[model samples]
Target chain A: MQPTGSVRPGGRTARTKAAVTEALVAELLEVGYAGTTIERIAQRAGVAKTTVYRRWGSLAQLVVDAFADTAGAQVPLPDTGSLEGDLRELGRASIAMLRMPHLRAVFDVVVREAIHDPAARSALTEFFAARIANGAAIVERAVARGEAAEGTDPAEVIRMVGAPYYARAYITGEPLDPALADRTAAVIALAAREGLLLR
Target chain B: MQPTGSVRPGGRTARTKAAVTEALVAELLEVGYAGTTIERIAQRAGVAKTTVYRRWGSLAQLVVDAFADTAGAQVPLPDTGSLEGDLRELGRASIAMLRMPHLRAVFDVVVREAIHDPAARSALTEFFAARIANGAAIVERAVARGEAAEGTDPAEVIRMVGAPYYARAYITGEPLDPALADRTAAVIALAAREGLLLR
Candidate 1:
């Protein structure tokens, strides 16, 4: 029988993958990236250690696969008719996402891994670069409507809008109120419209 | 002998603190917080283990003391005669500080500790709060000179100016260019002048 879309776990391979990723996240929160081992992860997932070793080949590959399987990295682009509105929505979503524990854990893993490993650092950098590239569509639309400067770099605008929340969260460990989201959006919008975020 | 201004390490206690702190930083980079032990720190510092045990009861206190002894916490306030100038100087300093290995280590310890420890989180929050309060002086000067809105929160201006650099450094792990400092200052200055950084 054909497995309908989103209706089933599909097969043994899919089930093993899901179990392994779930165990990976749980193990990450418990022992962190440095302490994670294929043996423990396999045992936690009730999968054969040989299968895990053969599939991943290395701890790095396993960790990367786990992150790829996590749902947190995917962020939606907003189209609210105006760049300001889109920015505001995106800013609010960014804050909300950071506050969510599971999502935050994913980022924490990436950040923690990047701290000591060069390859992890590059992976983290590339992941955000891709997201930033995708987010540029919002600014391109704004440019089309003459809401932003023609010479503006779209990624810069996204980075500017998202900076405050990320900075305050990691640097100060402060509580991020909803009001901050709005203020950041307004500030970024003003800067974008004023031709400040140029390439 | 009476202590003279800028004479030396002050006394024996200061010397011990300095040595222990330095050892702590080295151990941190090597073993990280989870792996840090008082025995290893004392042995590395060439200090008596008994002295370390008696002086700082717990690992937390020792870590805090190390941060206190760290020079990175002391950020000089720039009195550039205008809010714009002061903010620009401060922003550039923030970027440069992150790039510097020793200074970045100080912040990374704080951030990493705060991730798993509640007390460290409070201290991190309060330390930045105090810095923000002191930074408010810049905004106050601007407000008095009618360069900014009267209702503008001074700390908000500082945070706004500092946000981009901190966010990009940690999140993107990108190389911060000097040009970003100028642009950040200009955008923040425009916002402040336009009364965007409200209370």
Candidate 2:
């Protein structure tokens, strides 16, 4: 079911963009990147082909926008008063986001494209850079509170927190459990305290 | 050029298999997975279609075999007497392997296929399992020599050693530098000493 007659901030234009992005994601999961086309997405979204073309311009741009939209929807950073709590929340949120089938499908395509296509690679780089910046803020708060070392690089710390879980899930094909999130948080916290994440 | 007159240990069959596998890698790099076909591979390998079919049986199997062949040719684990030294060697070797254009192309295809295809997933799982097992042996040697904690999970330790570098390479699209390898080895060694890698 599509949302119609919605009175929002950006009105019909925002609704139309949302509809098309949603349709793009569905098309991606259904037929994969190679089979996904602007025509099919426009048809699925019940929007005019020209509208889809005028808005996104290219399939690569559309795909990148869809990925960015999904990533932007992730839960905001938690302020649980401690570095450990913040990292645990981040890890849990990451695992939860990755568990969604639609999101995982979109991410799989993005990662594959990022490896091969320059546009996709740059899009993914920008997306993660934003996420990493958010993660850095959490580590900065921890440092100010004296929970972590002074010189610990926030971005590097965030990367360490994520690396093991991602390596297991994407690379080694290991089963991702809640315990992994906890262990990842603990390992990063320990490494941070030991000044291993210093720039 | 095709080698016709070579008489080696496994002779023509082995040589033909190697040639076909090599051709498959080249085709994968040139046209990617979707464009690679048995017909083209057979042609490029200078072998008949029937020969290719009868030997590898399927394109999936052929791709898996090619990955296996390349992985098996990696440098053997170093016995540097210390866990840190062995891990550094492993990290350096992994970065070097991932830097090669041909190997990176093959790995990219395998990783993408593994995400979408059941057969490729299984092949990749098995391949990584073998690699992790080798890394475990190195850790086990360290444990025996008291370089690491007694109860460390060797596989987990190895995963820690690889996670940061791979997360940067594949996830965040960060540059894979020598410093990353050294830092990864140091962090894992620290984590191992702290008994964080215990099962």
Candidate 3:
């Protein structure tokens, strides 16, 4: 997180976005998506309601921007010179991301919001498509390195890393400790190694 | 649905339970957990609210009963005489379960309700624990047949089968098409065969 004194090019605008994002984070952490609303965010952040609407426009946009701006947590893809290493590194990073109360709440809201909103549905779809494509690079690198099967479905391989953790955290109401990251990564690494994750 | 003519052991009591469970399913399908209430379910089912209260004390109880019903979906464990075959069969069954609109909604409500209610959380936990333990029988049989590794964690292997599908359906807001069952089952089967899913 850049210091408030730095101002960072966008100046007051960036600060406002950060402030609104923080408010969203707080609201979601306290009450979750069902209790959160545009009006509540405005009140919590002390920002004008019109300003929130003019800028973010909707819950999806607000959540996307907030997630993107959570202390500039755009983690770089790992290149640990091996598929297993990269996935384990990525798994650790994912666990760190999940450790953030606000980010996890944003994800929860997105899933819940998509249930009833078409825009959120599209957003959810595009978000995963883009991310899956981006993350597929690890498997692609592994294939080039002669580690994984040439025809392995890169997207499925990539998804396998996150499924166990997300299922426990979101669906099963289980505690998602860091150790589970190792377990999930081990399973995916083994599966991908065996060429069993082909599409 | 036992024909009204072939009354089961509980007779009128069983009828009442079935009717209440049906009401719950309808309520969840129509309005989700947040919108459903004892009042709505009683009104919809033509069963008295007091009856619902006296029989099932909480939303979690009603949901568990509903899920256990829905046409007596107590599927027998797959014993295809092999781990991969058993997993594939179980995967197909899971996909079929996911395809049920009312059952899916009941699961959705349980997840949502668990977030705000401790009783729902316990129900969710107990439901998974019982199901996972029961399903582990397949893996245990596989181990006995020397298909999977001896030390493979039966519960973890069982959890793997459901995690990928539930994550997509419940977390990523993705369409959990039937094809995914094969993909996930393949990964878990390979991992278990290779002893990677060992606790």
Best by TM-score: 2
True contacts kept of 3: 0.60
Report the poorest 10 consecutive residues by lDDT, candidate 2 chain A: A1-10
The total of clashing pairs for model 1 equals 0
Residue-wise lDDT of candidate 2 within B1-199, one digit each (tens)?
Answer: 3344446668887888888988988998889776889999999999999888876778877877688777676458888888888899888877887788788877877776677677778777887788888888888998888878889999888878887777777788998887787777777887787787888
Error of 1 at A19 (Å): 1.0
Off by over 4 Å in 1: A1-11, A26-44, A49-64, A71-74, B1-11, B26-44, B49-63, B71-74
Q: lDDT of all the models against the reference?
A: 0.78, 0.81, 0.75
TM-score of chain A of 1: 0.81
Model 3, position A168: C-alpha lDDT score: 78
- Candidate 3 lands at a TM-score of 0.81
lDDT by residue (tens digit), candidate 1, B1-199? 4223224566777777788888877887788766888899899989899878777776777776566445335677899888778888988887887788765765676666666567667766777777788788888888998888879878888888878887777777777886788899888888888888888
After superposing candidate 2 on the true structure, give the runs of residues whose Cα lies further than 4 Å from its correct spot.
Answer: A1-12, A27-40, A48-61, B1-13, B27-43, B48-62, B73-75
**CAPRI level of candidate 3:** acceptable
Q: Model 1 misses residue B192 by how many Å?
A: 1.8
Per-residue accuracy of model 3 over B25-139 as CA lDDT, tens digit each: 8877778776889998888878789888777787767886565454244568998887888888877887787778877788766665565556667767777777777888898
- The true-versus-predicted C-alpha distance at residue A192 of model 3, in Å, is 2.3
